[model samples]
Target chain A: MRIVIIDDSGLRATVLEEGLRDAGYDDIHIVPPRGAFVARLERMAPDVVLMDLGSPSRDTLEEMLMVSRALARPIAMFVDHSDDAMIGAAIDAGVSAYVVDGLRKERVKPVLELAVRRFNAFAKMQTELDEARTALSERKIIDRAKSILMNQRSLSEQDAYALLRSSAMNQGKKIVDVAQALITASDLLGGGL
Target chain B: MSLRIAFLPLTDAAVLAVARERGFAEEEGLSLDLIRSTSWATLRDRLVYGQVHAAQMLAPLAVAVTLGLSQQPAALAAPYKLGVNGNMLVMASDFAAALDPDTGRRLSDPLGTAHDFAAAIGLWRRKPVIGVVHRFSSHSLMLRYWLASAGIDPDRDVVLRVLPPSLTVEAMRAGEIDGFIAGEPWGSAAVEEGLAETVAIGERIWQRGVEKVLAFRTPWLEENPDIVDRLLRALIRSASWCDDPANHDALAQLLSDPRYVDQPADLIARAMSGQIVVRQGEAPIASPDFLLFSREATPFPWRSQALWIYSQFVRWNMVEHGPEALAKAGAVFRPDIFRRALADADVPMPGANMKVEGALGLPLAVGSRKGGLTLGPDRFFDGRVFDPERMEDYLTNFVSPL
Candidate 1:
């Protein structure tokens, strides 16, 4: 299977290439840390893709999801994370899978297996965390949203949150979206939502 | 006006289901369309571009959005909290057993798991790594929180990495990971399959803290206040239904639907019921439920909870670059909108300093349910007594206005 690994991690790409080669499969190309990933991955046009979870920004992934979803040029092939359930879990966690349209499962399993392994490696590190407070990388957004809710709706802490939670439910939205909305709303509402 | 919303699939995604099912949006004279988003970034983009009016999002994602992490013109805003404490920390069973049986069977504090976890890393000589679903999730923060509290430097001491929830269990059993922190059922399933054991529930440590929130574009809410209000009312109702014990089964079925957790209905139901089977070759046993979709469990947003999150943000340096982090958090966390929604629904809102008892009592559903006889605590970590009025200063401190 001619595969292109679109990932930001060198170790992951190496590990996957090695594993796939070991499994008697080799037509593999690695794309490491490049901007405009969608364009490059498509330019490469490999039969299968072994992408990494948490590799790029949410915007990047969303673009990829849309590109794959809309164009059907690349279907969301499963990550080598483990199995179908794990890929679903990744999707739930905001990661996605893309494959070339009409790619057969046999053509992708080798690539998927490697992607799953690398994804597994990352999962190993994460499970050992034993708690969820590790995201210094992503805390800025949550705090900003909380602050907006507090200032705008005149919400006293939890009430602002209830506003967020209820909004998510009533609007069938995500908490993050509700938070983003409140900040946007505050800006438009002139500091009061 | 019709507002578009993108929802990530999780137990908490029920807000979307409840909103649509309850007809709250229609009642408010607003058109609602919920798009099931596969990833957080997609949800964020759809919401940001006005493609979707709102979303069921990560609490931290909203905060991150407002801070301009995504470099978007729009910022996530709202004091509205989506949900709380539907997370768990899990370890493979053999890994747990290897964690020094010398510590004795009767153990307190999940830190024991951490200690054993560190030891397991050493014993297995496995990478001292763990998995979280995303970089910007409560699981990541709580993993850091628990590890840091245990004096394990989350940064230097161990390698902190991100992975999808699906891989956590297999990773643990395969020795790819010694342990993991996630929403639910993953840990329980590990224990059930003899692949892992539950070290703690996020609820056990932080209690009913806000884990997720609804986010909207600032322009969207300003343009449509009535729609926002309507959205909240339905959410409040959904939260209420989730709280009822009888609805647990129904919720599990709802969540297990292909659109929700998408696992088997029974698996989703068991997780909701807190029925955990942590050992392979053994019967499934009950454990503390995640209480994601549970009600009364949903509303009553706690400033203390928000403050708790902010403290961690400050502790980790995630609060920088924002003007008056505390004020910003205060501004975003809206008790006002919450009260309006709950009051409109005729549900008595819990005080900002309310000391309400947990709806799910300890010793879940009766005599002799395995793992000894015990009930979950109704207390906080400080043991100084949790009070809302006292938490204001701390929460306000989350973002000190410049």
Candidate 2:
């Protein structure tokens, strides 16, 4: 019932570990992002390995555990042939698993499902963080564009905002898009805001 | 009208890129969304899980997938071959310097160099670790064949590390592996950066050796014949365009885009044009037929080729040898589907589905159903032929490395 999580991102691995811990699986090990991975995995002798699909070392793991039969016990990729939906969700969530051969599907299914849920949650949080960063950057761009409009046309902030909104509506674009266009044009005209 | 295909970033992905970028896919009323994947395993998962309609897969991998050697057993079908013979075997400069001084001769005579390699392995500081892209890859199988011929047991004499093609050069720089066999322009990139020297070309091991095949889930391909036909048509056009020397520059540029191979255009161009730089600051060697995308039915999925891969699997003990396993492996390459798709096209189609592999010593024009076709010079480096009908007899010739 030992579990090993192989991930380059410490944050994501910690998230998955916390989820697994809450599920009451106490025997858990986390392999660091890089280094002599095969030797470490051999030493750990994990009953099940949960790996990030994006890691390039997955191939190395495959060669050692699957092809070369370097491990004393055979390990097969955890595949629930009956649950295609779950498998698809796991792959989309960027998580993959390998388990010691002959491990029952029932024993591993909940663990895999939990990993998938945690991965999806982590991915959503990452998306939100990226969007928040983008929002901050775009807000700066819009402010710059507004100031350029206010300074060049000798208008107030309210007037510059209304002009940007009107231009966005007429051109069937977002206000941010129009603001970005204005900034680009202003930069081309050698004007600084 | 829309199809998503997953592919690893390599020069052999040129057909897929050309089909999408050159408007061939558009001309056939199809829209192709090419997903650049980081590894072969992920690409297989994407195709198996229905995230992608198809994938640019290693031919042996497609067979292995069907045979249930990797991951969940999915009936993956490869109806079209993306390209052939673009892989290079590169060893670190220090290790290669122990072999032949003439880089061109080293590649030209792989068997001689392989013996030299065996001799040099003892002279090395430690057991040389050779990086292969995947365990179920053609390059790995070829490396096994090339090394075993010199009595250098791949498993005993060397360590085979599996690294993605993109990471090979960096792996070399980090001193993690002594050499690697992978598709270009990763090999070219490594040689260009002066991290490694070319020891062998895949083409020299087996002329017109199978590389990447356009793979799809069997059920999807079976259920949607019309879409498959259209895709094959688009790929055929793209492959012809890719094979033309006149279009090498444009094709190289197209593949150099961030979304594709993402290497320098000049480096990518070498593989396509068959002009390779084996060593840093050395003159390029012209092999002329190094990589083939089309012409001589390079795009055709020959069933014999799949059986050849199966033979390697049995040789290496990767899969249990049995009638059921053999049938499953051979069926991975669908020549029937390929012929059905190209039935009405102006291009020539081979009359038979299988042939004696490595039997074609020189290019010979053969009778075809649609037009004139020539196939050949598909000789093995060891000069052995693989007859699909006599697989047992063919396999008896090899002494198992185990």
Which candidate wins on TM-score?
Answer: 2
Fnat of each candidate = 0.12, 0.67
Score candidate 1 by TM-score against the native. Answer: 0.60
Candidate 1 segments whose C-alpha is farther than 4 A from its true place = A1-193, B22-32, B70-73, B100-108, B166-176, B281-289, B292-297, B321-323, B351-402
How do the residues A1-107 of candidate 1 rate in per-residue lDDT, one tens digit apiece?
56776666676567767877888876888876343455566556566655554443333443444334334364443434345465444443433345666776666
Please list all clashing residue pairs in model 2, or write none if there are none. Answer: none
Summed backbone clashes in each candidate are 143, 0
lDDT of 2 by residue, B112-146 (tens): 99899999999999999999999899999999999
Interface RMSD of 1: 10.2
lDDT of 1 at A111: 53
Writing each residue's lDDT as its tens digit, candidate 2 over A38-115 gives: 888888888999998877778778777875345678887888888889878888888899999888999999999999
